[model samples]
Target: MDMIADFDLTAHNTFGLKSTADRAVLIDDAAMLPELAKASAETGRPLKILGGGSNVVLAERLDAIVAIMRIAGRSVNQQTTDATIVTAGAGENWHDFVVWTVDQGIAGLENLAGIPGTVGAAPIQNIGAYGAQLSDFFQSLTAYDLKTGTIETFDAEACRFAYRQSAFKSEPGRYVILTVTLALPRTWKAKRDYAGLDRLPEDATARAVLDHVVALRASKLPDWRVLGNAGSFFHNPVVSAEAARAFEDAPQYPQVDGTVKLSAGWLIEQSGLKGFRLGPAGTYDRHALVLVNHGGATARDIAALATHIRDKVRIRYGVDLVQEPIVL
Candidate 1:
């Protein structure tokens, strides 16, 4: 792979902001990792692993050498009476992995379909959607210990998964996930417990769940290629039950479990920032939480808009909305 100096990362990220990377390397093969590591050692630059670039904001130029994981492989290892065991390469597209599983007649990951990113980054964030998460179907994985330069296997519990957080995310740059092993069912088991999808038919199978989720998302979210967005911009701010109760009398609050789950979109809209534009970066009119790059948006513009919205919400609702995407 050619090592380019001062590459523009705006095109690499989903936000489409113009930012530079001091150096970047795309690892299409795992065998080249040693060489890449050696080069980094000589250069004294830590490598930043990036995937589909769906969930990050380019805040500043990346000073370190960026290592884009491109390792690709997929295999089904076991076919039991009720389930099938499969493993996906780190560089495989996350949505493509879902499609592959569905094509193999496997169940359990359909609800998480259409999330933009890579298979390797999936476990890193324990990405969740429509009542399902990457952990639900995950069995284990082999991640390379960046320091030891050795691959090690980690099972489900070792991941320390919770909501939208994971061990990989907590300890960034420590491991490079090589392959993900998943346990899927041959039979249908839909996570239809979440709202909207709970109306599935009596015989609703995995395929049905997949179709329904895709249709639901098609209605709610805008296509990133056309409109330029990185899905949800902010995570649902989780608050205490007492905080939720205070809003119980309010018309805009919803309680989830014992915590108060407030929709960041609703808050953004309430703050009258929907369709609000700042130098070509605007909040999607249909979905307030989704920030769109309306052609020629700079990284500075998007960052300003995010900060503006965040400040507005805190001032108005007394709740601080945290940005979901990793801001570099």
Candidate 2:
């Protein structure tokens, strides 16, 4: 473990917010976690695990011992008649990992091609896109439990995955994910029900689906490197069937639980906040769902803009808008 005091974290997070940590510990190997845990315990400071920093809002200064996950490895764990089990180190880039699977002729993860974050962060947020979620292909994961100072494995059930939520997210800073395993189907099937993908042929190949999803995302969301934004800043609020009837103009998808998932983007656009700016933070003009940092923006700026968007949406639609990113 490599430790640096008063570490600059502006580059660590996608939002490009100016921030720093009292101490930043680089964890390039899983084995380093035990030693780091011991050091953290000795110092009496809790461990804060930071992955790719794609889905997080960082404060101006973090007073904790921030462990930057950089563990790296990937392998084909096992093969069964129906599926292929693969494993990736927690620090592996999520999009690159998805591309690797596709290059290997694996098909289940194609619909989730363009999501930003690390493999470990995927299960934490139950990351999803284009009608598919990480939970759909999950097998299990290895994590270092900070509370008990032991390594543990959690299956899908233990993960308790909901839309954009997981047990890790519910209990933040408790587990440091070391690796993620996914079970991809041997037989290929195209999932083309989502909007942009609906135009694809019923028998589209996994590569075709992946290419389309990537293109769609590229066209919609700005590159975080260029724009400094977290993609899809808010969750698509699920409302009761009766309550959804109030917004006839909003796009609504009926859920299995008899609720309706309304488009958060549509609501924001309807509320006239698209391309809206407040200080250095604003809503992206192209996609209202994304919140961007227009240079020199801080956590407080993003928070204020988020609060503004939420208040407007709630006032107009009587529905609450919850942020998707974890604020640290």
Clashing pairs in 1: none
lDDT top scorer: 2
lDDT (0-100) at residue 6 of candidate 1? 90
Best candidate, TM-score = 2
Assess candidate 2 and give its TM-score to the true structure. Answer: 0.97
lDDT of 2 by residue, 1-328 (tens): 5689999999999999999998998888777877877887888767788888999999999887898888899999889999999999998999999999999888799999989889988998899999999999999999988788789999999999999999998788889999999999898779988889989999898999999999999999999999999899999999999999988988989999999999999999999999999999999999999999999899999999999999999898887999988887
lDDT of 1 by residue, 1-328 (tens): 5888897787788877777888988887777777777887898887888898888877557887887778899998998897789999999998888888888777778998888889998988799998778887889999888889988999989999987788887788889888999888676656778878989976787788888988899999888878877889998888887776655534343445666677878888989999898888999988899999998776688889999999999998898988878766
Residue 302 deviation, candidate 1, in Å? 1.9
Worst lDDT run of 10 residues, candidate 2, spans 29-38
User: lDDT of each structure?
Assistant: 0.83, 0.91
Candidate 1, residue 269: CA error in Å? 1.4
